[model samples]
Target chain A: MTGYLVAIATLVGIRALLALGLNVQWGFTGLVNLGVVAFFGVGAYTAGLLAVAGVALPAAWAAAIVASALAGALLATVALRLREDYLAIVTLGFGEVLRLFLLNEAWLTRGANGITGIPRPLRSWFPAHYDLFYLGLVLGCVALIYLALERLRRSPFGRALRAIREDETVATVAGKNIVRFKVQAFVIGAAVAGLAGILFGHYLAYIEPNMFVPQETLFVWLALILGGSGNNRGAILGAVVLLGLLEGSRFAKDVIPFLTGVRLAAAQQMLVGLLLVVLMIKRPEGLLPERAP
Target chain B: MAEPLLAVRDVVKRFGGVEALAGCSLDVAAGSITGLIGPNGAGKTTLFNVVSGLTAPEAGRIALGGARIDGRPGHAIARLGLARTFQIPRPLARMTVLENLLVYAPDQAGERLRGLVSRPKTIARQEASIRARANEILRFMELAPLASDPAGTLSGGQKKLLELARALMGDPRIILLDEPGAGVNPTLMRSLVARIRELHARGVTFLLIEHDMDLVTELCDPVIVLAEGRRLVEGPFAEVRRDPRVLEAYLGVPA
Candidate 1:
């Protein structure tokens, strides 16, 4: 029972990292990146493929980051030209395309049969402490990413990104290369997503094309908006809280009478959507609004 | 005596089939306050937009600092020391006045991905001076009191001031103002005119688009009149005020 709780905690921690990446893009830069799952999947697959092929965990992790960043850069090269809603559509399409590619590409990812036997980091050395070791790893990653995000939000470049979000014209007249700043932000966000993916892949020790679902991307976005879109801490908090609500609510059908499992699941999602609407209507700033002067 | 800071040579703009600027040409000399005066829809703003890289001309060459700048983006033109203000001030509502200034200031060291991972100290070092300078500019614009406020919260006049401050963040030689006095109150408009004159005295150049003839005459050394999207004539404000085309465009009379 304790192990199961720790596993869930690990999931929450990893999802929180993904939420922070989306927050930086959508909240600070006004960039609508709807394809976050693709980057995460890229990192996961990169890490998973390498780990299963006898590579060291650290090296596999390094490959995961490189793969994700490269994917982000490539996506930015093509999709950065889109504006607002168009950007959202293109990103969503790009994620779909990547998912389909993963689904069909058998030579590299073993197609839909999925890849397994992913070696956990330090598993041999800490055999009895596997769950705790992995928990520490995820927590360590979350801490590092959180610190980086906080510094980024306070930096000059981050401020420029927010300014670009407010008004691109103003930024442009002020001598900001609006396009360049945008691409940088998008790529960085994607890289963060990829990092989250690497963590998730190792935790699962299993990889399949379906793991990079569009629903997962939407959930990360929801977590970000829920946590306070522009704020890094808020994003992570939102992810854990929202994912908890989603998973925790499942236990209700077992305890309560007359409620079916499927009904409870549907109810959970509806409640999440309702919470989003209510938040947007009332505060619009999320639980943790952006820190402003 | 010096060559023009901004030269729009025989520019022509067509919207579908309607000719907006028909073979228009104008020269803004270095370190002078020049006014572009015309009635509503006279193509003054369009010409300004085209020159500042918001709109590309169908047939025209724009030269700034003795180099062509017709086909560049607005930011590119801005990087070339040409700044502009929209008729409606477009300050990013979400950012503070200081953040707005920092956004446009050239960032060579902080624009890269590696800057985040490896060059933290360099960015930190660069930002202190940039923030200090931004503070000084905000103070000069009488905006120090509200430097920390969200730019959207400012009054019409202050946002205009914020826009001007944003332009100056760059070392711009020429500024194209699209009706700086349009939404501002009378007193702030006077302050705006004063600021323009003061900046002019400091050797910055301007191509002001103004409907307020009084403000134009007070600050502009030479006023260029436009009608139906083309330059009609250019002369001293007093002379241009008395020009038939100028009067006709304003009052619809042959005064």
Candidate 2:
């Protein structure tokens, strides 16, 4: 039971990182980035491939961050030119395209067979208690990211981003470079998501293209919305609650033996959808709504 | 004669089938409150859009301080010391009233990611100074009491005051205010007029579009009248108001 709890906690920390990234893009900058899973897959693949090739873990992580940030910058340049709603469609398409690339590229991603034997960080040091150490590592990372983001949220750069989100024309006339700020925010958010991917790939010791489906992106969005979109603490809390709901629902199979496999997955998705509807209607700002600064 | 602070020459802009600005030309002298008046569709707003870089002119030259600024992006033009307010007040609605003004402070090093991360102390110091300046501007606009309130919560007249306050935060060389008095209450209108005059006296140049004849007469010298997307007359308000062409543009050929 303790092991199961630790595993769930670790996953919550990982998902929190993703929620924070999306908060920067969607919550703070008003960018609708529906392709978050693409960046996640890029990070996982880049780090997993490099680690399998005997590269240092830190170097692999750095490379993953750079690669994902570049991808984000490229997407922002193309999609931000269109209106906000069109940006959503473009990013959603980009996510599917990336997943297809990962599935078909046999030479690189092993053609959907997935990559295995990816080494874990500091595993040899805590072989008997690796899960606890990994939990600490992930939670430490979440804390660091939360601190950095909170500082940024209170800074002038963040203020400018919020202004751009509120009204692009007003921000432009205020001497803010709208394109530059949006691209930077996108890149920063993508890089953070990439780091989350790296941690997730290492924790699982394997990664498959299917793990980064569009549904995963939706899950992060649900987490962000459940916690509170614009607030960082809300994002972390949301991730914890979301992971709890997901894990707790697993016991439903035992309680009602008729629920199994694909049906269970479908039921989980329905639950998420229902929760979103409730949130939109009753508490659209989420559990921890952003306060005026 | 020195050169005009802002000079728009033979500018043309079109929106699909309609020509919004057709070979329009004008100049705003330094430290002058220049008025741009026209009927509903004479393209006064379009000209402001073109000059402020919100809309690019199809053919023309616009210069500020003798430097061509026709093709530059809006933010770049703004950073070059030109600021403008919208026809309808556009407050950064979610941000606090003070934040709306703080975001407009020029040369904020903390606005960049590198500056933000690398020099925390410097950024904090700069932020404090900017906040002080923002507070002062808020007080001047009589919006100090609402500094912490979300700008969206402000009344329409208050939002207009916030708009002018935001533009003032940037220490702009030239400000293009589109209808500064349109929706403001008369009490607010008087204060707005006094504020514009005060700012102008401090060497700030203003090019304002206003429908209130009394306001324009009291504030503007060298008012420019537009008719059918072109300049019809330019002179003092007293003289320009008496121009037959100006009257024809407003009232439609004396019919």
Pick the TM-score winner.
Answer: 2
lDDT against the true structure, per candidate, is: 0.84, 0.92
lDDT of 1 by residue, B1-255 (tens): 788988888899989888889888999999888999888778988897788787789998889999999978877888888988888888888788888787767754765657867887898788788888899888888899998898889988899998888888886898888888888898888888788888988999999998777788788878898888788989999898777877888888887
Identify the CAPRI category of the predicted complex in candidate 1: medium
lDDT per residue (tens digit) for residues A1-293 in model 2: 99999999999999999999999998899999898898988999999999999999999999998999999999988887776677788889999999899899889889688999999998889869899999999999999999999888888988998998899999989988998899899999999999999999999999999999998899899999999988999999999999899899988988988999789889998998899999999999999998765
Error of 2 at B251 (Å): 1.9
What is the lDDT for A149 in model 1? 76
lDDT of 2 at B73: 91
CAPRI class assigned to model 2: high
Candidate 1, residues A1-293, lDDT tens digits: the string is 89878989999998998898887789889998889999899899999998898898788888888888787777776776664567788888889998888889889888898888877777788869689888898889889988887877787778778878887767766667778888788877888888899888888888899988999998998898888979888898899889888888888898889779889978988988898889889978888888863
* Candidate 2 error regions (>4 Å): A82-86
Q: Which candidate number has the best DockQ?
A: 2
Best by lDDT: 2
For each candidate in turn, the TM-score is: 0.96, 0.98
